[model samples]
Target: MEKIFTLAELVEEYGTEVQKESFENNGNLNRRSFDSIIKRVEQDWESVKEEGRGSKRKIKCSGKLEDKAMKKDGRVRSGRQQVEHRIPMDVIVATHLEYDMTQQASMSLGKWAVEFGLITELEYDLLRSRHSSKLRQKHIDKAIQSGTLEEDQTKLLDEFTQHCLEIYGQLVKTLEHMEKCGIILFYENWMAYGKDGKVSINPEIMKKILKARRELMKKHEVVEFNLTAHRNAKKVKNFNREWKETLAEVKDENGNKLGIKYYWKEYAVILKASSKAVQRYLETYCVDSLEVYVNDKDLFINENVADYELKRKVNIMKKAEKRHKQKLQEYKEQKISFATAEDEEWIRFFYTQQELEDIVAGYDLGVKRLHLQNLYMERMGQLFELYNIKGYNNKKHLEGVS
Candidate 1:
């Protein structure tokens, strides 16, 4: 099939020649003349191509240009880094606060040494004896100075400390940003248990807090969208329940079952969807909205029928998305470990998903221990949706279901 070049490409190739000719023949560039030109290209595609398909066509813009937004604020948002540290929670909250860090109890050296493999178990015991309880970063430094830890290990400790400082800085900046908005820490209830366990405030208190916050949320418009809009209907599979074999009704050889999937007659509508419907429906209108006039000899799918440049960009993005999903799947199945290449982008992406999923799942389990470690953070969970709606999330005026 011959390529139908866009107006921009033709203008670029023939320069003023095509534009002048098109202008003269069409009488000052009316829609009728432009349409005739496009129609002519459609009609004589083979003839034009057969004469000089020799030269490769470099496509140019086919439509209006877009403006890019740039931030005037000095705040720089860095890409996520693959570093974490065991900064004392108090120091993290109080770095800008006046304090002699040396006076504070250092983190346990035995734990740090064991986690980082900086020293042997016997070496850790010796160091712990010398420094007393709660081994600190200084203790690790002393160990390295005294020939207990290798020089490379000393470098690792320094990196850990630096990473901690960087994280603390980012945290402070984020808090500042939040404070600029209406969010604030107020009347926090905190408690703690053994390591690694986290839970919300007691259910009784949480119920009251959530009720109050939800009432506040009602003061604004509750933007809505099809939450499952991202799900591709074609790709959805039937749910496979383990108990189906036992509980499902018996089927005959013809595959007829005693039971079928059920649907309710009255579907409760949640959307303020009329405007959104128009916006989304417009996408599919031009696609197969009208029949193509073509000979029986040649027919093909027009899946990538947009502007050539746009089609190319879409293809590039699809390839990138495929690679990202492959990496994520590999990470999920334990094929890709983030330990060695923590800063690598795919590693950070995988770890972020893993960490967030873990935090969510962990929050779902056990009782509400009411262990609110960070005062500023406690009420943030309640404000999650509010942030997204109030433009703090940086996505505003969405046509896609909010």
Candidate 2:
């Protein structure tokens, strides 16, 4: 069985070297010394324990094991009790003293260096405030002024700023994309808890509230329609004149003319119509308008702007031949060059030279069949026959093979 040393036992066995060093070196135990002692204890725990006891067995162990050992002893013996960490007050004081000494050394070094012209006052200040929030900015400024910080550190700081800018740009782009995608980003907080100590607007409660609102609107519309129909029940001889001359006309239960004020109901209908018209207009035009704006601003570019731009260029090329009759030959040449450049750029960024050459060759082979709708099918047939391959097929049949 593997022996398991408790934290206390490990500390006691390893800590002696650190304790002796602390006393000799003005009472200080550093992280490095502590780590070294811990490593040595892990390597030879039993040896350290024997050294601590002057080669005598200090740890008492129970002789009784399981059934056989207990039968032999005729009585049960308890297992060995583990040691506990019991630090003397002197050790704590020594630790504090060491910390204070180090702090004093750092302060003295910083002050002396600044005063003696070894380092600038600003550089000294920055070193003093190395653990502060303004550390990076102060370090960057000092590095820029003195040109003393390492190249990697300067590059890292510059990269950090670039990363922040990229993040901000992405956020703006994502928001614009969401708008174009018909997603309304609402920011609202409702009464979460009521004075009655009841949970008010939880997610479920909000869902119910929305349901109620829709139900209420539906009922309200039906009631308003009934009222309007009842009010318009009586016909006037001169309809336009009667409507223009009407003052306070009374309304029945369904708001029919019992001859006194139906204007309130008429006003309600006008308001409802206006509201519906606005909603309808937004539903029809808002999403497209937002998408156009997003595209115009190149907002989507932050996420896949390069890909989108490449696609856009390809689309322009496809339309060019039809749109530019007078410059047909020029458009064709431009399209071919654009395609070649795009392929080269993509290959350079993503592939090895040999792979790029293979891809370019494949594209060249496919170019002959470009005008065909099933161009891949035609090219694959030719490629397969040229290589004398079998069992493989063209695009349409390859779908089933996969």
Candidate 3:
């Protein structure tokens, strides 16, 4: 029997005053990153221990990742000292996984994962078991009970009883096609601890990831961050910063000319606003009417003014129309070219478009087929970016990846 060392045991055996400090700045074992990674590892180890299966990996020290322990006398103490180490503190242990026992452990975890709602059963079967099986009656009943799926669409999918049927079914073939075509299709899930705790990546999960994934995870094995600071950064990028400028004449109390007021405001807000916004703004300002200036002249003028003073909106409309067409053309060109290229790529990769469509059609076990399609699209999009970037943003997937 192979003996597995608890992290703390390893630390006590190998750590000295200088080992942790000496490896602190070393590229492979960054101290700060390791500090956080170890905290997560300990927590995961504890969770497994608490659930009674932690025997796969014993815990050297157990504590919540976020808080320090308070003694019975109410004094706080450091939880992680010397003997309680997390990986990247030691390179050899961090990257190691037991090959013989990992698969069974992973299947147990995968089943537990489904029971806890981390991933759908179909996803677990495809990713973990890869064996022929029938669609769980639970999923089918739930989909119907949810009522989002149309009866007709649900019926169409229901007819494909062999999709996951026990008799060497359609699912295996579909999955084979998906894998061969480099079409990334998998459910997203993580067994996360409390609000501030870490996501547990079981040895089983790691084995699969290591088997096929890039070197990033292995290279940075000890620095895994469950929550990234950059996850939502792009949402606010350039937000409300795009501005537009227009000129409007301001009249004096006596209706004399007041030179143009150069107005500037957010372009997106203005473009997206409905006509009702104009009335709302007028009410807020306690003004009876406000003239809109488009391009160089006033777009709205009362009959009290000269007919010639009423600037026709034709010029403004022309500009809007031109902009609309340009945007549409760009979208069309990019979309058509990308779709064609992707289709070709699928064929070249040995998975036909018809097979993909059939696979999707088989999975449409609900009325909300669009929602189901979106999940696949999102997964595929991630795969497209990842593989394409490895090829240095190859010309094929650039305009079409989105």
Candidate 4:
């Protein structure tokens, strides 16, 4: 198994070279540096003692004996393995502090960490405590100078206080950027847990988180296509024309092709005509009438009158009705003419299916553009927080007076 390096061991062995090469090599601290540090830590592991807990021996397991016992048995046995202290507590704590510092700086400056890699939970806690202590001590010494305490340690207190304040300010800015980007705080916490830590986020959970964040930022707009209505109208006109053409070829028996006259027959013709005429009439006029009736009975009845009273009324009112129908037909033709012109205008104004599809594609492109823009803004905010322009300016003013 590969040995893990404690923070102190990593720093003592590799930190200087990693930091020096990082800027020149585009901020990548190579694996070779880490490997060398790990080698050194493994060589010294037995001698290294745990911090604060005096003279305690490192834990170890007798793996050789366990392997021999397992080989002797025909059946394999399953049980918990013995725990060994592979990495020292001091190293773990130091590594975590270094990682936290690098990460905190990266978040504030919007720059990748060059020297330190990942931190552990113990290190993070230690760094936080050290920061808090320096801040509190600065305040305590200032109070003491105002006769709060007779003796006070004020040496380099102002510089340490400023450094702590700078770090805190950077941390706040980094947190804000993370929030804006929808980055969960749990990632940092998880990293702090170190390699031996078992807690982890599943890939499925991460995918869902990404999806939700994307949806929150997405903006949608509807686009419509007008082809359906136009297509239906065209279908209706084609079907009507086809029905009329089919009805025009009527014939009758007596070997004569019957015209539309054969359609007025009240009963099946006991041929006063040839079989050919009768058959032709039945096939053409009869079939045509039946088909018309099936498609639209109202049209068939309007063009073919049967009642005596209605026929007589039709003859008597024929001239008046023809004039009235002519006027109505003329009015309907004019309405149809106007409607056709309006339809052309509407076709020009509205989107076609092709155009609507293009618009939807443009919306998808906008989503990517918007996400990138937001990310850029978030990164800019992080950089501004790192520099501490306000504090730097205040310090310059105080120095000019001195």
Candidate 5:
């Protein structure tokens, strides 16, 4: 069995000078702040010991303890096992925010921490700003050290350019065809508005057109990709000024202009739909009939298929909304922690079926709280699709009857 140190012993051994300064007033080494940290560290240690060194559970320690352990064998020891030391905290203070930032998928742990009342908004903002700057500096140092700073920048620019090109190709054709047919495009889900005897492009294309248009408008605003601006050229005004203007002055060995600057205007002109008619046409299409194609087969040509898909989405949305509202009420009652609908959507987007199943199956080693089951069940509900709820109900009834 591993030894667990008491709060007093831990404060005596590992509390930083600043923490010790508060000792005279608080008497328990600022126990309010450190309590969660102590629990987190103990949880991590227990997880590592039970799961072994190969576990993804990060083993954290106080910097002073880690330094002492490193001196012994150039590695940190957790009880009888050697574990990798990632972040070092001095009595699990605000420094632990860095670990959360690293572990969080979206790097927005600070916001969530504040939302959960683990930290005050002021503390969250300050810590986020401070850590973000450190992360930026660290990125710069690593990029410079790898000698791939320029290469990475150019690659990113190229990828952005390609994305713009793809967007232009798709949107220009779809919008033009819609205009020719006098069809109006709506930004909302097609089934919501278009199912009532309306003709327009599907919701997917509508999203692409909107996103592509935004990217086109933002082309010049992208500072790093503005080659002329980087060179401090005199004709910066001409750069991304119009559809006719070239993007950059760079030329290849053959004197052919190079980079996104060369074809920037052309891409923008075609993609941006700058003409008032096209812009309005993008916002509103007036066509009464439309056909959707998938793999050269008309999808909506078979009304059954379109109906099936629409019905599927409607069922999904109904179930998701019901479950989400229930979870929200549960959260209000303090029976469970709840994620917002947007967060649940992200969970649906990012988590695979197997991953979600693993989480729901009590196999999520990292999160063992009682409310976690309730939370993940909500996520599973979000991902569930019931195209035939009536059929399912009948089957369930038969099974229950048996």
Candidate 6:
């Protein structure tokens, strides 16, 4: 059986004169200081106790890391302390399972974990602040049901959840956009190996796709939704503003001024609006107009195709026209799902022309899964730059050792 020491005996055995300086004027230990020391010792008891005569008695830390902690002035350095080593503080804390260091670091680690197959998509959702809020409210509701919370406390929590709802709704919109554009699915499919014992479907193709996805995520991580307030359209219309310069009349060679161009104001407003917002507006207001334009087949086909000078060019156009009709028939027959205008626009940003063509033709889930695994490897390389964790960043660092 192991020996157990009471709080008094442990303090008497390990507390130094310097630690005693933190005691109260009445010669009693300060609870805060004592707790701090206890926590530090719990994290690195071996290093703390090894300097004294009672060093032979070993005490284990609750954390997974068993390495001796760095010491300064005979006190164990806590996780919050700045690491003096080559690795970053965040990296060290994450490796030791001390996630409370920083939310940004923890979120980055969560993404890295998903990329490396260390965690599932469901597990990663818990790391998101939006999901965390929902989960908190869930427990709050449960507590209310169980009559565990005071009436005042319950009221406050209910009000808090209501305030969080709007922010949660915004987060859901952005996350749904991510899911629609295949970012979420990409990570989900990454955590698997193929039949050939290789992860990627095609490394060369996936490298480009992964880079595009990374750029997209980085751009949107701190996105401005402009949810609360609208742009000052009233101010833009004022004559005193610089936007008036855009409305300046066009000049002719003879110095005669043309009428003020209305297109400029339209262009300015459209340019200021987000693509999704603009698309939504157009879809709501211009659906009939778009349908009318699309149905005008005469606008698409040239009446004088036979008048072309080059036979090769004419043959190519004919083939294109034939393929168009085939695609229309395929849509009519419902053999393949047709991409919406929004989806097409989104897809153009993330895929190459050839890849988009193949996707429109048909995509195999197995092929996509393989590609995602390749993308995973590419993403892990980027994660290494974010956190300089030794072994995970470089495979060669742990090539031979188990």
- Highest lDDT against the true fold, candidate: 6
Let me know the TM-score candidate 5 reaches against the reference structure: 0.19
Off by over 4 Å in 2: 1-136, 149-153, 157-402
CA shift of 331, model 5, Å: 38
Best by TM-score: 5
Per-candidate TM vs. native?
A: 0.15, 0.14, 0.18, 0.13, 0.19, 0.17
lDDT of 4 at 386: 26
Q: What tens digits encode model 4's per-residue C-alpha lDDT throughout 1-402? A: 223334444454446765545524543334565444433343334233223211121222221211111011112111101111111111221222322333242221112211221122222222232324343343334334433222322212222222323323333333332232222131221111112332233344335433543443232111111111121345434533442343233222233222221111011101122333222222222343445545654564443433312332233234333433553444334321225887757754786644544354432322223232343223222222322122234334323323
Which stretches of model 6 miss by more than 4 angstroms?
A: 1-19, 22-32, 46-232, 235-402
**RMSD in angstroms, all models?**
29.6, 34.3, 32.9, 45.9, 30.9, 31.1
Ranking by TM-score: 5, 3, 6, 1, 2, 4
Model 1 Cα shift for residue 113 (angstroms): 21
lDDT of each: 0.30, 0.31, 0.29, 0.30, 0.32, 0.33
Across residues 1-402, which tens digit of lDDT does each residue of candidate 1 receive? Answer: 334554445544433566657654643444444444443342223234312221333222232212111121222222211112111111122221112222222223233322222223433333332222233444344444544344333322322222222322444443343223212221223222212233223445335434543443343312111111111222211111211231234232354342312111111111122322222221112223213312210121122122322332343334434534553454355433344664557656756754644444332111112111221122222222221122122212221112
Candidate 3 TM-score, true structure as reference: 0.18
Candidate 3 colliding pairs: 133-164, 134-164, 149-366, 149-367, 150-367
After the best TM-score superposition of candidate 5, give how far the Cα of residue 215 lies from its true spot, in angstroms. Answer: 13
lDDT tens digits, residues 304-331, model 5?
3334334434534454456446644544
Better of 1 and 3 by TM-score: 3
Worst 10 residues of 3 by lDDT: 86-95
User: How many steric overlaps does candidate 1 have?
Assistant: 1
